[model samples]
Target: MTTGTARTVKVLVADDHPVVLDGVTLALQRTSWLDVVGYARTGRDAIAAAARLQPDIVLLDLRMPDMLGPETTAGLLAGTPSLKVILFTAYPDHAAVEAALAAGAHGVVVKDVERADLVDAIRKVVNGERGVTAGIETDAGAVTARHGLGGRGITRREYDILRRVAMGQTNPEIADALGLTRNTVKTYLQRLMEKLGARNRVEALARAHELGLL
Candidate 1:
C-alpha cells in the first residue's frame, strides 16, 4: 500500500494487442490506487510515452513485434530513469528473465495474472519492492542456478514437464496434456535430466523438488 500522501501510480501500458491493452487499462482505471496515464503499442511508442508521461510504472509486454524481449525493457529504463517496469508475458524465457533483472526491471509478471495480483505488483513496484507475480519464483539465487543466462536455466516449459512427471504422468500422457509430441517430451526430459544431473525421471523429480523448481 502507498502512503496516504503519495499520489496514485501513474501507469503506461505497452502491448501490441489491443484487447490486452484495453483490458489492462480498464482494470487499472478501476483501481483508485492506479492511474492509467497512457498506452503504447510498440517499444518506440513506449519509450516516447515514458518520456512524455513520466509515469511511475510501465506495464510492458516482453514480446513486442517492433522491439523484442529484454532490449525493450532496457530501452524503456534507460530512457526513463525513474520509471519502474513490470514485464507482462506468457512466454518467459531464461535469457529474457536474466536480462530484465540485470537491466533493473522491478518485476516480471505473467500475462494471465489476476487483477488483484497485478494491482499488488504495481503497488509493490511503486513502493520500491520487487514485484513478481505468480508461477515465476522470486529467489534470484535460485533463478541463477536454473537460468545461468547462457542457455543454462531450466526453462519454464521444462519446469512444467517436471511438475507433470512428479504427478506420475507417463510421457504420452504428459504430451497429451501439454499439447506436445511424445518425442518432444522425451527430448525435454532427457535435457532436463542432464541439467539436474539426474539418472532418470525419479531422480529428476527429486532434484527438482529439492531445488524448489517444482
Candidate 2:
C-alpha cells in the first residue's frame, strides 16, 4: 500500500534475451505500483531509453550484443544522473557483484529470485533504499586498494576468490582454498557475475583485467 502520490515506479527493462525480458516484464507488471516505461535489447538502447524515459530505475542486463556491462552502466549513469540502475542476471558471483557496485550500479538482482522478492527489491529502490542483493553484501572497510575506495569494499572471501579467479583457478581449486564445496563455489561465482554486472565468468574476469583489478 502506497500513499497519495499514486507513486508509480517507472522502470526500463534492458536485456538482450527475449525470454528473460518478457518474463521479467510480466513479473514486474504484476506489481500494481510499478510501470514498464520502456524496453531495450542492447546496452546502447538501454542508455538511450533511460535518457528519453528518465525512468526512476532501469533493470539492466549486463551482457548485451551492442554494449558491455560496465560501459553500458556508465553510459546510463552519464545520461541519466538521477536514475537508479540494477544489474539483473541469472548468474551471481562476488567479483562480478563487487564490480557492478564499483561501476556505479545502485544494486544488482538475480533473475532467478522469487518474483515477489524481486518486486520488493524494486520497491525498496523506489523508496530510496540501496537495494543491494542480500547475496552481494558489501562492506567498505575491507580493501586497501589505491585511492582507498571504500565503496569498492567486497567481502574478504570474495576478494580471495577474485585473485584465484584471476590466476585462473578451477572451481575445484577455488573450492579447496575457500573450503567450499564445488557446487558452493559455483554458486558464489554466479553471484559474483551478477554483482559485477557480467553475463558470465569470462566476461567478469575480462572486465577485472581491464580495470586492473586483477
Clashes of each: 2, 12
Taking all chains together, each candidate's TM-score versus the true structure is 0.64, 0.62
User: Against the unseen true structure, what C-alpha lDDT does each candidate score?
Assistant: 0.75, 0.71
Q: Whose TM-score is greatest here?
A: 1
**Candidate 2 local lDDT, 58-172, one digit each (tens):** 9888666664455577789989889988878654442344555666887677778888777777766667767356233344213223222233554546655765676567999
Q: Candidate 1, overall lDDT?
A: 0.75
TM-score of 1: 0.64
With candidate 1 superimposed using the best TM-score fit, by how many Å does residue 97's alpha carbon deviate from the native? 1.7
Give candidate 2's TM-score.
0.62
Q: Candidate 2 local accuracy as lDDT?
A: 0.71
Q: Once model 2 is optimally superposed onto the true structure by TM-score, how far is the C-alpha of residue 11 displaced, in angstroms? A: 0.7
Model 1, poorest ten-residue lDDT window?
141-150
